[model samples]
Target: MSNTKNTAHGQVQETSSKSSSGTRKPIVLMSMGAQERAGHEYQVMTKKYMRPLVEHAGCVPVLAPTCFGSNDLALYLSMVDGVYLTGAGSNIDPSLYGQENLTPEKTQDQDRDRFDLPLIHAALAMGLPLFGICRGMQELNVALGGDMYQKLYAIPGMREHREDYSASVAQQYADVHTVKMVPDTWFASLMQQAEIPVNSLHGQGIKTLGKGLQALAHAEDGLIEAVHLPECEQFTLGVQWHPEWQAAQNPFSIRMFQAFGDACRQTVEKKSRN
Candidate 1:
């Protein structure tokens, strides 16, 4: 709801004049939500975290609202070159995927899901570049016929979702976990490092991978931490960890954003020619 004209990471301001002809415009769509402190005060908070990632990668961060209905969803989806499915506090409704309710802690954000599910489908149908982080990753899997572990701890021996000693959302943490990237995968190439360290902060993980999704990375404990669609021409990735949170400080994180931004650019250019 609050529009701040600034680059990704809150550094640069975008200008039409700065956007040159033949230069592709990468439009990044972020999910919306209600403020944590003020219930019902809905706004797009992902932009605050994603702005740096998008702008640094030379892409325009577009704040897409979850208020769009079925009639307007298609129109909005068509405008973006790529979509960034950011993290959210609510869980996807079990009914959407034909599953029984798993936990009592599940918080439903039907309005947001209704708005994003169609958009995700439209992007995939069009082969637009898409990136999912944390909840975003889970949603992507669900959209593609995968399921999620409603509560990670409920599964015996699972690690904690909310790290007790980690820093706040705005700050970076020194505790890094290792993930093994699949050999010859786009993610392996993008990150350059096969075993990389990443921040941990999510309770949910992919239960059953969706069709066409390749497992690109896994945690030390063998948890599926990253996934991608190989059929897409551009980079379409989803990570269980939040890259935007530490991308500005970590080279690995920055590379992930850069790769996604490059894909977005390509998609924009291809669209413009047609």
Candidate 2:
């Protein structure tokens, strides 16, 4: 069932739609990128990120186009129970955090960077359940006054975290390293373990922890793998890994999605009473 209505401008409007079970599924607002395919610009979001939100999280995913900008950010946030910031093929523009374009030749989604950064703040201000993956996590950090390493591998003592393009797709996404969860953190308790195997696939990594954000897990190389606002009672989290990839098959990914789903459900309940 579709949970959104389309406007002539290509923006989406949320609907009070219910599934066949006579219950409304929690709606998640996913930010989209403005990309050109075959000489035409398109609002695009990867399909992998939507699957776990539907299959495991029991929510209806809705797209928020980057072309529309921040004029309607509040209206969009008000219509959904959660916000999901997904990864992209292009990197965020470095100027957002007072840095020069160190990687000018690399592709950059400036439109998305402009929109999603403000969307992150509006979602947090509204106390919506927020989840970010890969580039999404970096966006969240920058929005909250943090910075990133443009090229993670070039840093002294930092290991190469980019995926092996030469390997098979499954092999490239397969677990390649381990991350140690901080004891007593949500992740450690959720997984019930100290260390968990994870896949690494990114050229950029967090260099400074965002304000009010705490590290939930870290790779053996000391790179922060997961972060959350410790003071935020709502579900506000960002992970450096791509848990949405084959998420249904991974136990850790399943738990993460379920937790996010539960948080979205709680938001629905709270909004219903208001």
Candidate 3:
């Protein structure tokens, strides 16, 4: 292992040689948000908001671009210590979730799903710490045999989670509703609170949790706001909010990243020893 280096185009990975005891940050492979940029097709990238949070928590950020095949996937799984799945402007294609009622207005990033879904399962199988936000959570659920409500507001009791298009960014992310924490749940134990207010930025949410996973928090309308895989050996927690947007100032958001960073340190250290 040498100093921090670039292994591939648009990819950044840091090794143990340049890191310190408490600073020997583990390389966390973050799944990119895909979309066509300018005239380029399949422009693989991630939001800038997620970087500082992971770095402040003692972890190195690396872009895990859409791995196109099994060999690429295998290479990444062996290189990184943890995974962070970020929110996206696109939605997972309805076909993957056994539903086909995708509204024409709903954006779909098929390229992102192809790699993210497989990465989720692979990381979980190998006991790697994984954290997902918004679309990331939805993909986690679908990857584990779960389904989602395409438009939660359509339900009789479900509150609309979409933000007002005209509101300022601050107003949109402002606490719009409350989510009650389930007692004795994995997230409850870490968050150490009974309830939390989160930003509403998605129309889709987990309608049915995947196998081996349980709801950690729910909205007043009974819509799941967070999920955790209790049976998993490694750390796994997915929230239906954009914590990265204000992770540095938000208490809950900070805790989430810090906890994940600790897990990543342990995972990488163990892997290095082996």
Candidate 4:
């Protein structure tokens, strides 16, 4: 019933013989939990939609709450083979990218920024696979010295990316746009297609790509739909759509997770050998 074999500290304990005692699963730490509820005041925790998708990817998805301090953060980073910065209702504080929250209401996750920004940097520094979706993508760009348009809709020529509130969850997540792949990119290599349709749901988007990152795909209206860190030499990628939604049903979505799973597996093997 589980995809993980056995894991710990970013390593997968794979046994060569039948008598092996234990095997640690390769865990991919998801930095999320319960944010806020109608009657609740404080966001006791954080949560993500990427859990089941990561599990489908063939690794353990561990919830990493919004923790503080360098020491504690280091511990979280060390225990996982990869990081999946899940999308949230909040947006990265504009201040991080040298802008004020043009619309404070649209900017809700400063607390999250404190943990996620550093997490992205640390994961990349260690060369662990890092993937971002929606808000996660914006955080990655900001963390790597890129900027985002506070309100994507406000920007001329940009189409609406938010899901319609009235529709059911399935209808809301319907793929409404086509994202064409940029030639000669890692994402393209995985897809092996000129373009593919993807579901869109976000309030903000990248204005300038972060340092060492490159666009992998763009929407019909010319917005960057996906990006990757070619220089990192690890699996560092992001997409504006919600691939986690019914991921197992789509070839593109399944391929994305499989790639991440492969990266996690590779990390486990490297650690096991060392």
Identify the runs in model 3 with alpha carbons over 4 angstroms from their true place.
1-23, 42-48, 67-70
Q: Which candidate number maximizes TM-score?
A: 2
Candidate 4 lDDT over 149-249, as tens digits, reads 88888989999988898999899889998999998877888997999989887878889999988999999999999998877878888999988888768
Lowest lDDT 10-residue stretch of candidate 2: 13-22
Clash pairs for candidate 3: none
| Residue-by-residue lDDT tens digits, candidate 2, 1-274 | 5566568888686645564445677999998987888999899888899999988988899898888778999889888999999988889888888899888777898889989999988889899999999999999999998999999989988888999899998998999999999999777898888998999899999999878989999988999999999898899889999999999789999999999988988888788788
lDDT of 1 by residue, 51-114 (tens): 6655566677677667655567667777787888888767788777777878658567777778
RMSD of each: 5.0, 5.5, 4.8, 5.8
Clashes of 1: 5
Candidate 3 residue lDDT tens string, 1-274: 4445557585576545335664456888877665766887665555444565455556877776673533487688788888888788888898888998667687787767888888888899889999888988999999998998987878887888999989998998888888899998767877888998788889898988888888889888888888889878788988998878767777888888888888988897897788
**Model 1: lDDT of residue 74:** 68
lDDT of each: 0.75, 0.89, 0.80, 0.79
Sort all candidates by lDDT, best to worst: 2, 3, 4, 1
**lDDT (C-alpha) at residue 55 in model 2:** 86
CA displacement after TM-score superposition, residue 220 of candidate 2 (Å) = 0.8
